[model samples]
Target: MSEETFQRYSAYYDLLYRDKDYETEADSVARALRAANPNTHSVLEFGSGTGRHGRLLAEHGFDVFGIERSQTMVTTARSFTDDSAVGRESGIFDCVQGDIQTTTLNRPFHAVLALFHVVSYQTTDADVDRTFANAARHLSADGIFFFDVWHGPAVLHERPAVREKRVEDATTLLTRLAEPRLDVDRHTVTVRYSITAQSKIDNQITEFQEEHCMRYFFPEEITSFARKTGFNVERSEEFLTAQPPSDRTWGVAYLLRKRT
Candidate 1:
């Protein structure tokens, strides 16, 4: 709901997600949304960081509106579609700045999505419920809502306590250190990131720290919550396929339809 950490990552978000197959993921979700209804035309994308998925949706001929909490991310997202000279024009991309838990739009959408583990950012049940309620308020009757979250079994089994990686480009060297803390009873994991970037200009190492807390709900718990929030639970799958989640699965995607 806040902006400082997201703002700091805005400059490097694309670089970090460059390796991720966002286009493939968008295609998969779009196919699922379309199969749910032939008339699906407009989509609302929450936590649409840098408009990566939004652009893909536009390319698929769907009207896409993105909501993000960070002003810096919204600015970068706007540039993706607004800069005609840059030749990255997807006129269907529109971005707004607001938190998913409390934002409202003028009209309802045919479909809604929150990809890239955005749902995990909600560390409390109240936050999750508020987000689902807000999304339901903006969804047309029979519209589908799709989202993904970190898999509880995977986190509990793997217990990835620490990680370190570095990315170097022509102008910058970015180093990242991650420390994970697990709370078994809460089914929550808090990751602390210590990031250091050395600018090519003077090779100065600038340091920044960010803490992200993610709640890992069981598959049944999530589906039950969706049903309680007035959604007809459609399907929950491991990753991109319709399969039971396992201890090694990193995340699971859920598809829910607004009760008609």
Candidate 2:
């Protein structure tokens, strides 16, 4: 994985995910937060790429602080925040580039968020452990942690397949092909993405390759890590819905609270 993944795609990120409904996701996250602690107004988001979800949360009245590892992503997120009414104030939507696994801001928030498989992006045991520790450190006394990741049972049942996506606009045309290589022994999948972008007017083309290594997780694995990281698992359910996870569930969201 060249660290340049987000750097390469930050500009067209919103266009790439034009169909994504961040408002619904943020609402779901808010529901979970309210269920755990009704008065969550501040949030710290891990791996907050492009700050899409963070902005939505901020619009919904949460003071959002996002941590991203990519400088380009941070810049893009900051630009978006600067342009939005909900984020015109610096305190409403602030983003920083830092290692999510071990960053300590000397502060705690009403909640901690690892949306969009930020947890699965930590493919190593050490990475996962440190990320959970970071979340624990950033959470208030009664704060809750919310995260979603690829479900191990679903991954095992329906193995990953090669996929391609294309999004085009008046300015440019973008294509992405994802080829997955699964390591069952390590319980990880490395997806090699070939991205091609072409300018509409000049007919100029640019191509780049990036490998994203992600790990799928089981409920037990989450619980075990939670125990070691001073967190308590409150709920594990299929993401984007309240249904309990099953073998067919592709993604699972876990809600956790700091161990008191």
Query: What are the Cα lDDT values of the candidates?
Result: 0.83, 0.86
Which stretches in model 2 have alpha-carbon errors above 4 Å?
85-91
- Distance from true position, residue 164, model 2, in Å? 1.0
Writing each residue's lDDT as its tens digit, candidate 1 over 36-106 gives 88899899999998998888888777888989988888988898775422334343878899899999898
Work out the TM-score per prediction: 0.93, 0.95
Lowest lDDT sum, 10 consecutive residues, model 1, at: 82-91
Clashes, model 1 = 0
Candidate 1, pairs of clashing residues: none
* True-structure RMSD for candidate 2: 1.9
> TM-score for model 1?
0.93
Clashes of each: 0, 0
